[model samples]
Target: MIHFDMSIFIVAAFLVFTLLVGICFSRQKTTFREYAVGNKQFTTATLVFTVLATLYGGGGLVRNVEYVYRIGLWWIVIMLLSSFGLWAVGRLALRMGPFMQHFSMAETIGNILW
Candidate 1:
């Protein structure tokens, strides 16, 4: 069996490797386009995962898990409601990229309101 020290060292090494990977992907940006979207190109899978994280990265998952534990199968209603909300917003959010073409969310909102 692996010793505790070995397990800790393995976990630390994995974290360092992930940090290095993120650093290596960092880019020098001079243009708004490069700054808004990174200079490094992301493939379809990366984009999909990025979108998923953006949509659900908060305590949504944890809250849903708790709801499931406490209320059992009725959690499906909560999950479905959340999914439906996303689906409703998804179209506007998608068009947002091209419609306003703003580099930031604050900029987009300001533009929409003003």
Candidate 2:
């Protein structure tokens, strides 16, 4: 007599379903630009939301909360300063956007230097 775990079957089914979905939705032909940056048609609001989600997603929110609990309100000031630094870097990136047409950071740095 063999005992089988039902949860294993559920997980296997989910993995198969996810693989099928990915195969069905994947593009057949994709350029480097398209693969790297998508269509580049995102609106300002969409880009803003995406950036915000990336910044606050994963364990970042949890880590920040833990820091605040452990270290008091100064963590918030550190967060604000970090956000300001990010904003400044974003502005600098925008100014260098023209040099990044190929989406290569190395090329952009070379262009800036020379």
Candidate 3:
């Protein structure tokens, strides 16, 4: 059987590699377009994981797991409902914020392009 230390080392190495890859791409040429955006050329898979982590936080997952443990396995529905509610609210506010004000709470979500 594989030892626990081996597994931990492999996971740590993989994380270091991933961090290097993302950081290597963070710096790029500076211009009105490049400087404003700062080279956000992420792959779709990376984008998916990034969005998932941001939208469904650690607290939400912890709560859902706790609910499932107490309620005996049907709490996934509650988790889904809560996630959907948050997504709906964000979508509505973002879709409306641009028209209402120059700098909305939704603007906080966007790039400042400085």
Which number leads on lDDT? 2
lDDT of 2 by residue, 37-81 (tens): 886878999999999898899799899999999988899888888
Error of 2 at 63 (Å): 1.7
Candidate 3 lDDT over 1-114, as tens digits, reads 955788889999999999998789767545664454435566889878987898669996787677788996567676666678867876887866444433344555564453
Flag regions of model 1 displaced more than 4 Å. Answer: 1-29, 97-100, 105-114
Between prediction 1 and prediction 2, which has the larger TM-score? Answer: 2
Judged by lDDT relative to the true structure, which candidate is superior, 1 or 3?
Answer: 1
Off by over 4 Å in 3: 1-36, 86-114
Clashing pairs in 3: none
**Predicted candidate 1 versus true structure: per-residue lDDT over 1-114, tens digit per residue:** 855778889899999999998787665435768767765588989989988898677797788788899998888876777687778787767876555456677887788888
Query: Scored by CA lDDT, what does every candidate get?
Result: 0.77, 0.85, 0.70
Q: All predictions: root-mean-square deviation over Cα?
A: 5.2, 2.9, 7.5
Best by TM-score: 2
